[model samples]
Target: MNSGRLTNFLIPLLAVLLGVIAGSIVMVISGYDPIAGYSALLYGAFGDSYYIGETIRQMTPYILSGLAVAFAFRTGLFNIGVEGQLIVGWLAAVWVGVAFELPKFIHLPLAILAAALAGALWALIPGFLKARFKVHEVIVTIMMNYIALHVTNAIIRFVLSDKSYKSEEIHESASLRSEFLQSITDYSTLHYGIIIALIAAVIMWFLLEKTTKGYELRAVGFNQHASHYAGMNVSNNIVLAMVISGAFAGVAGAMEGLGTFANISVKAGFTGVGFDGIAVALLGGNNAFGIILSALLFGALKVGALEMPSSAGVPTELVDIVIALIIFFVASSYLIRLLLTRVKKEGK
Candidate 1:
């Protein structure tokens, strides 16, 4: 890697190492065995084929969600409404999957498509307002999240009143399950969603790195005024970027609905997947491959947290604390650079 990219990466890796060290300290002070806790954590994440499969299953939505946030960031937009977009998309996917009865090949793709379109459309509301009126996207997207939540709840209640809590399970025709994969993984919930997520990550990477539309979108993101002066349609690109980002978020929702849960449940609050995407994006430095690895790391941590309390008498909250510390250090990466420079000067 070039010096810049290498530095960009090394700093974050260092931050992760430091976070682990900090977590060890916390465990030691809390009357917990740090070594035992981490041993349990590692064992829970990969001790068996089943646990490994579960980790990958958990990573499915994370990859797509991270890509969603990364895409918006690439376009110089903050899509704070990923939670809402994901919810709506998930609802839409489940609604379509349950409402339809067709061949698996046909029904599955349609359900997935429905989710992407729903997410894209939800994002367009804020995208349009920002493009047309120059409103701040962060505020608009945040408000849109609450609107999405209430609207989705009402839709769910109205359409599937028979259940009264969760939507009906989708027909098997629309399911994304993979019996072969499950069998191989010792009957874990791991589905074909991982394949879809990997494909989506590739698409996102290609779209950003190897296309004219990507160039324009990124150019618009970097400097709207300059792009406008350069004869680009800044407004259109802005809206387009958001739409694409929302579609990815929607696909993430579909992973849960069609692949994981196979039904949509009413929520008293926003699903944490969207928020976690932000951390994944940050940890990945907004790169597609990086996001995949980061998602795996997070997935392992999440699954491992379940074992900590039982196996080592460590509170699961320590995982959250470590994650927060990692984020803080990453956000303050300039400090890392300054320290590096000081060491270099001292060596000189």
Candidate 2:
């Protein structure tokens, strides 16, 4: 890689290393063996085919959600409402899946499309508000999260559910589960959603890096006044960016509803996946391939953490501490850059 690319890669890598070190310190302070804890964690995530399958399954949504946050970041929009978008998308996808009867090809795509459109429409509200009324997206998105949660819950209870806390299971035709994958992975929940997530990543990369519209969006992000003066429609680009970001988040919800769960439950609280996406995007440096790798790391950490208490006599919560430390280091990257600069100067 070139110098710039190398630096970009090194920053996050070093942050991860530092976070690991800090976590080990915390484990020691807590009277646990960090080595054993981490070993168990790793084994739980990748030591067996079953674990590997689960890790990949967990990674699917992380990839899409990371893409959602990263897309908005690229366009100078803070889409804190990905959680809301994902919730509504999940509801829409499950509603379509349960309410429809069609061939697999048609049914599946239609459900996924419903999710995307739901997310897009939900996001359009904040986008429009920001574009037309100069409202800050952050406040609107945060409130929208609560709205999405309650609205989805109400929909499940009153409209989609048979007086239950969850919607009916989706039809088989709308499912993303693959028998071949299940058999190979010891019947884990891994599904074809990974393929969709990968494809979405590619699309984001192409849309943001290799297109005229992408350039215009980036330019608006860099300087909206300049972009407007240069004859770009700044307001429209803002709305488009949020819509696309919401679509990615919506697909993330579909990965959960159609692939992992096959139904939508009335949530008592947020799923946390959307919030975690912010950390994923930050750790990934908002790059497409970087987000994939970052999501993989997070997925493994989460899956592996489940084994810590059982195998190493460590609390599962330690993993959360480690993850927080990692994000802290990533967020403090300015210090890391300074350290790198010092090292280079000393070497020279």
Q: What does candidate 1's lDDT look like per residue over 1-348, in tens digits? A: 886787878976886777778788877887888899888888888989988999999999999999999999999999988988999999989999999899999999999999999999999988999899999999999998899888888888788656497889999999998899899889988999999999999999999999999999999999999999999999999999999999999999999999989998888999889988888888888899999998998788778777888888777677667556655665565677789878868998
TM-score of 1: 0.95
Off by over 4 Å in 2: 338-348
lDDT (CA) per prediction: 0.89, 0.93
CA lDDT, candidate 1, residue 98: 93
Q: Largest lDDT belongs to which candidate?
A: 2
Highest TM-score among the candidates is held by which one?
2
> What are the candidates' C-alpha RMSDs?
1.9, 1.6
Candidate 2 overall lDDT versus native: 0.93
Span of 10 residues, lowest total lDDT, candidate 2? 325-334
Per-candidate clashes, comma-separated: 0, 0
